[model samples]
Target: MKKIMRSLGLMLALLTLTVVVSACGSKPLSQRNVLKTDQQSKTITWGVKADTRLFGLLDTKDGQIKGFEIDLAKAITKQMLGKDAKAKFIQVTSSTRMPMLKNGNIDAIIATMTNTPERRKQVAFSNTYFYAGQSLLVKKGSSIKNVKDLNRQKGTVLGVVGSDSVENVAKVAPNAKVLQLTDYAQAMTALKSGQGQALTTDNGILYGMSVQNPDYVVTGGTFVSEPYGIAVDKAQTPFRQAVNQSLKELRANGQYQKILHKWFHNVKGFDYEEAARE
Candidate 1:
């Protein structure tokens, strides 16, 4: 009788363990969403930049984040989810964006992130949504016509922290000094304050800076190509593929052109049509 009771107790414990393991294994992918979103919720939380002007910026009047990247992310989210899908924006900076995505704080990141091999190790990227190039921003009448001109001892370039521009500028202008700031606003302030002779970043971003400050100009058309892509957590192949499909559909339906034109058409030096090319 004693042996039988012990056997029964052991059997009950084993069964309970199996059931608990199965429950954990069977948890739905939707429940594990980074932003705590799912089909039922019909909402996609996006990590966007509040400081970037054309890419993502907070409008002072309405207090809403608006820009080309914001519009693009919304379009993609709608296409992937449904027409009625809603986007909830969360502001993320260059340094915080990746960590936020990793921590499940945002569903997707679309704030001017460039696709690179190193980034791919941490997060999967959607197809190339936009193409830009590294360029230089300098004060008007400054002699820095191109990146080549910055390859001098007295020249210095400012870039934002967590952006590849600082390392990239070093590769192009080996002799020039490089200073990194927390964000574009700070980088620009540093430039205005004479912390750096020129600001180095994508031409599209440089153009946005120029629009705000007429005293500055974007020179050196393109030193390196920067391809932007939407990012999701690594190993999420299904979600990444869905985003890629949406991008292709957007391009085929001419929606891509409409969005691109709406933002880049007024920029002086950028060629919108060329950028639209695959």
Candidate 2:
């Protein structure tokens, strides 16, 4: 009787595991293997970067999120549902974007995430909305002029933990000493303390830091092309199409351009038309 009872317990555990895996595999979307904004019986949560300045930043005093990415997300939410789709925000960093999507913690990720083939395996991406690139941020009047000018053996670089942006730096400077910080704020601190000769990351993020300190600048040509996209779970095909279509409409009606102009165009070195193109 004891042996029989133990076997039954094992069976139950296996069943539970199967159920959990099934839940992780898919999410609610009108299209198979994509996400859609079809029905609105519930509110949708979007994952955004709370620490990155230009892309996503928290207004501590106002208790609001304000940035180019936030504005775009709000516009998408408004277009997908009625004027009142009711959207909530979840703070996500580079490391949290994928796991949160798989677990259904967020319906979509509108952070400055790049659409790469490796990431595509885990989550489906909507049409590319923003065009940013991997660039180097260095102290102004510093000797570092470009990637080719970087002395990997001599310079230390700071990056966010597990970020795709950091991966590009390795390829650009094979021998450069690299350090990973937890978030944008920590990374900036490390840079300011002279822990690293330079900080390498997305151009949009660097733009925010540049705004705060004109002494530091994003220098050199864009080394790696990074196309930003809205991320949905790989199983939510329908929802992905709907969201992409909404973005298309935004571009067709000139709303997309306005958003870019409002936040990015004002930043020096940003091209509104180029960013609008896929």
Candidate 3:
């Protein structure tokens, strides 16, 4: 009897373990979610930037995130999944966004990420939401103005290692020294320390930086065009389409414009018409 009881207990334990693993690997299983938006499963995870100031940042008073990107994401979620869809924010960096999406940690990435061809290979992108151009962030009153101005004499151009902007800078300023930082924060720091003459990245990001510090300014026109898009795993075409649909709906309903004007209009040097175009 003791042997039989022990065997039964082990079988039950094995069954529990199998159930737990299956639940972890697979999304919530419900036949009803096949066609309908799972209203009961009203949870949408969005990947957003935590460090970027104007674009996305933590509001100390409310203990909530407030930014142009986050607002747009919320509007999209409400339009697609209804008001009940509780939006969950996941802090993601330049390198973490792709892996988080691929592993299903995030439903979409709305961070200030550019839709590069290389990134397209790994994920699907929506309609061009915001059009950005690569530019230089230099110290206020600095002489550096444009990529054409870059030469061996000036100084190093700081860029994050994995960012598409690094390659763009290399192509644009072959002779200029290039320093690769791990992330945008470090690159900006290097620029401040005089380790690099200027930092090259998307103008939209530089716009945020310039707003925060009058001592820093973004110089030069765009050397390369970067179109912002919402990204999802390449394999999740259905979800990708749904995201695009939400974006389209937001645009049609004027929600997109509202979100844009709320954060961006107040931002200095922002051109709305220019950003909406591809």
lDDT of 2 by residue, 210-273 (tens): 9887889999868998899999877777777878888999999989888888887668887666
Clash totals, every prediction? 0, 10, 0
1 against 3, candidate with superior TM-score? 3
Give the whole-model CA lDDT for all candidates, comma-separated: 0.85, 0.83, 0.80
Better of 1 and 3 by lDDT: 1
TM-score of 1: 0.86
In angstroms, give how far residue 144 of model 3 lies from its true place.
Answer: 0.7
The 10 consecutive residues of candidate 2 with the worst lDDT sum are 29-38
C-alpha TM-scores of all predictions: 0.86, 0.86, 0.88
Misplaced by over 4 Å in model 1 are 1-37
lDDT of 3 by residue, 64-145 (tens): 8878888888877787778877677998888888888776677788998898888888878988888889999999787787
Q: Candidate 3's C-alpha lDDT?
A: 0.80
Model 2 residue 133 CA deviation in Å: 0.9
lDDT of 1 by residue, 94-150 (tens): 999999888777878998888999998888898888888899999999988988889
Better of 1 and 2 by TM-score: 1
Model 2 bad stretches (over 4 Å): 1-38
| Model 1: pairs clashing at backbone N, Cα or C within 3 Å | none
Q: Stretches of candidate 3 above 4 Å error?
A: 1-24, 27-40, 152-154
